[model samples]
Each structure stands twice: as structure tokens, then as C-alpha cells.
Target: MATPLAALAADSAGDVAHLIETALTPVFMLSGVGTLLNLLNTRSARVADQIEKASDLLDTEQDKEAKRKLRHHLRRLTRRIMVLDISIMFGGLAGAMTCGAAFVLFLGSVRDASIALWLVALFGAALLSTVAALAAFLCDCFFSWDNLRKSGPLPKSVKKRSPESSASTTG
Candidate 1:
């Protein structure tokens, strides 16, 4: 007759396989959240760069009207960064909750305990957080679009990047 350990070993393979299947959904969601976070961070960085340029222009600008315009642009850019920050925060929260849900699921499987409630709660919260992040991103898009339309074609005090500029090198 097989020992208890041997029987457990025989049964564990199917249990582990089921756990992996159940865990895949959260992993996919986490990947999407990571992608969104990447987008938000990149947009925030670009906006920050614009803010720095605008600040420099505001300092050196002699015309009253130009200074006013620079200040306005700076305000809009700041608002964009704020919205992006919100998106980033929510995206990060979603990612964390997704990871937590995965952990709970794994723990439940290993311990032979029912973690369905906790998993559902965490996954649901993650979904909500993802929705919130997307909403913030959409708001930022609207703001950016309106700002662009009002500002017209020319970008004041912002230079185009060209090859050989060598302003900042990337590996």
C-alpha cells in the first residue's frame, strides 16, 4: 500500500496544474497594468521636460504678453502631470492588488483552504483601480487635446530634437 506522502505526491500534480490555470488571469491583468504604468510614466516625464523648458523661458522672457503665455502653458503642463500622476498611482495600486490576489490564490491552494472570497475581493478592487486609472488617462487626453488646439501649431520656446544634438545620451 502507498504511504500518505506517496498518495499526496500523486494528487499534487493535478492540483498544481489547476492552480496555474486559475492564476493566469491575474498575471495577464498585471501585465496590462504594467503597460499602462509605463505609458503614464513616459507621458509624465515628457510633461516635466516641457515644464522645465517653460520655466527657463519664463525667466528669460522680457515681454509681458509672452510671460503671461508661458505662465499659462506652465499651468496646463502642471495639470497634465498631476493627472498622469493619478493614473500612475491607480495603475500601481491595481498591480499590487493583482499580485495580492495571486498570492492569496496560491496560499489557498497550498493550505487547502478556501480563499475565493479574498481572491474575488482583491481582483475586483484591482479591476476598479484599473478603471480609475483609465479614466484619469482619458481626462488627461482631453486636457492635452484642448491645450493643443488653443495653443495653435507653433510650440513656444520648445525645440525639436534632432540627431547629433547630444543633449542627453541614452544607452
Candidate 2:
């Protein structure tokens, strides 16, 4: 009967709407998490630069107490940097999982405007999260490469320092 078929369609639409709602919450959460992680990464990079500068200043100091304080701060900063890196990686993983789940839901048999709207919104959030994750990952890699260059066996410096110079020694 037409009435029974219409009822079944309405039930199916309701189920799809529910699925979209369930998927959307996680998608938005993941997007927010990713953005926060990126912000943390940027802060960590700045802190690392400050730590390096502080280390450089300590090298020129003769005060034992000041040197010790500088070293302590530097160590703390290194630990924080490591923590930030780990957090970013975890956030990226969460974002990827959330997007994947949303994509699965999009493939379901849903026939409703509300369901479509939710699916589109979730997908957009997922895309933004993915972009943030990628940007953070690339920045991390760039910093890693810069670190390697500085610590490499032979840094390609334009001005070669003498073996006894402070520049080469501090480095």
C-alpha cells in the first residue's frame, strides 16, 4: 500500500538524519582539536627559538648560577616541544578518523535535505582539519630539517669559523 511505503520512507529519512547528527559532532570536535594543535605547534616553535637564544646568551656568561638556570629552562622547553609534537600527531590521527567516519555515513542510503546538509557540513569540517594537520606536519618537517642542517657534520656556512673561535665552539 502507498501509505505503508510512505511510512517506511519517513522512517528511513529519520534514521539518516540521526546518523548525520551523530557523525557531525565528532567532525566538529576533530576540526577544533586540529586547529588548537596547530596553534600549539606554532607556539612551541617560537619557544624553541627563544630557548636557543637563551642558550647562546648563557654561553657568554661566567656566572654559574645564571648558566644553570638557563640550562634548566632550555631542558624544560625541549620537553614541552616534544609534548607538542606528540599532541599534533595524535590530533591529526583523530581528524583523519573523524573524516573517514563521516565519509562512511555519506555513503548511506539517506533521502532528506537535512541529512545532505549535515553531510556537507561535516565534510567541510573534515577538509579544514585535514588542511591544518598537513600544514602542521610540513612545518614540523621543515624545522626538523633545519635542526639537522645546524647539527650536521659540516654545516654549509658562508663564513667558515676558525676551530678556536667562539662561534664554532658554541655551535
Candidate 3:
């Protein structure tokens, strides 16, 4: 009888170990979602800065053409900010769902409950949310890249030139 009891304990321990091993993948996924959220936040800050600069220029600029350009930039910045915000939200959702899945897995294992359906549903929700977040991020990247390409090279003020007085000395 003691031998049978020991075997039962060993089997239970093995099940717990397996449950922990299975949970590890979702933990790693949570880490990945955190990384993506950080990147989205950084990009959002940059967009906010650009929006501030554009708003400032709009207030002071008298030239019609320049004002129009500034307005366009502001519009683009606003759109980019919205997209990034959505991406961050989705990423957060994914992380939360993954956490819930991990918790459910542990609970089910301890209670000896059949939670396979719940596990699958939670994991599937996490995966779909992650996919949506990534897609939004990709769209934001395209918007940023297109704007940079359209803006062309940096303005003349950023370019270095030889001083007029120094130019004569070279001869």
C-alpha cells in the first residue's frame, strides 16, 4: 500500500512539472509584448514632438504655403499617433490574456479540472490580439517612412558651408 501511495505522489509531481513547462511559452510571449509596447511608446513620443513643432510653426508662420505644409504635417502626425495608440492598447490586451491563460493553466492543474477548452480559448485570444497589434505597428511604420521620404533631405540650415571670409583664403 505504501508503494502504491508513493507512485501516486510521483505521478502528481510529474503533472505539476509538465504544467510549469507548458506555461513557460506564454511567459516568453508576455516578454515579447512588453518589448513591442516600449517601441510603440517611443514612436508615439516622437510623433508628439513633431506635432508640437508643427503647432508652434502654424501659430507664427505668415506664409500661406508654409502654413498649408504645417497643417498637412499636423494631420499626418495625428493619424500616426492614433495608430500607435491602438497598437499599444492591443499589445496590452495580448499580455493580459496571456497572463490569464497562465493562471488558468495552473489553477486547472491544481484542481484536477478539465480546462483544455478554456486554455485554448485564452491562448487563441492572446494570439489574435498580438497579431492585430503587430499589424497596426506595421501600418504606423509605413506612415512614418512615407513621410520621411516625402520630406526629402534635411533643410539647408543643417548643411555646413565654408565661411565667406575663409573662401578667399583658399586661393
Measured by TM-score, the strongest candidate is 1
Candidate 3 per-residue C-alpha lDDT over 81-109 given as tens digits, one digit per residue, 9 for 90 to 100:
99999999999999999998898887876
Off by over 4 Å in 3: 1-8, 12-17, 153-171
**Which pairs of residues collide in candidate 1?**
none
Candidate 1: list runs displaced more than 4 Å. 1-18, 153-171
RMSD to truth, every model: 6.9, 11.3, 5.6
- The model with the greatest lDDT is 1
User: Model 1: what TM-score?
Assistant: 0.82
lDDT winner, 1 or 3:
1
Worst 10 residues of 2 by lDDT: 151-160
* Residue 37, candidate 3: alpha-carbon lDDT: 88
- Candidate 2 per-residue lDDT over residues 1-171, each given as its tens digit: 345347446677777577568767766777686676777678777867867776675666566666666666566557657755765775666577566656656554333224556555655655565566556656655655665465432212233355789676798
Q: TM per model? A: 0.82, 0.51, 0.80
Model 1 lDDT, residue 163, Cα: 62
Kindly list the per-residue Cα lDDT of model 1 for residues 1-171, writing each as its tens digit.
Answer: 665456457877887577568889899999999999999999999889989988998887777787888999988999999999999999999999999999998787667678989999999999999999999999999999999899952246544455666555643
Rate residue 103 of model 3 by lDDT. 88
Give the total clashing residue pairs for model 1.
0
Task: Give the least accurate 10-residue stretch of model 1, judged by summed lDDT.
Answer: 153-162
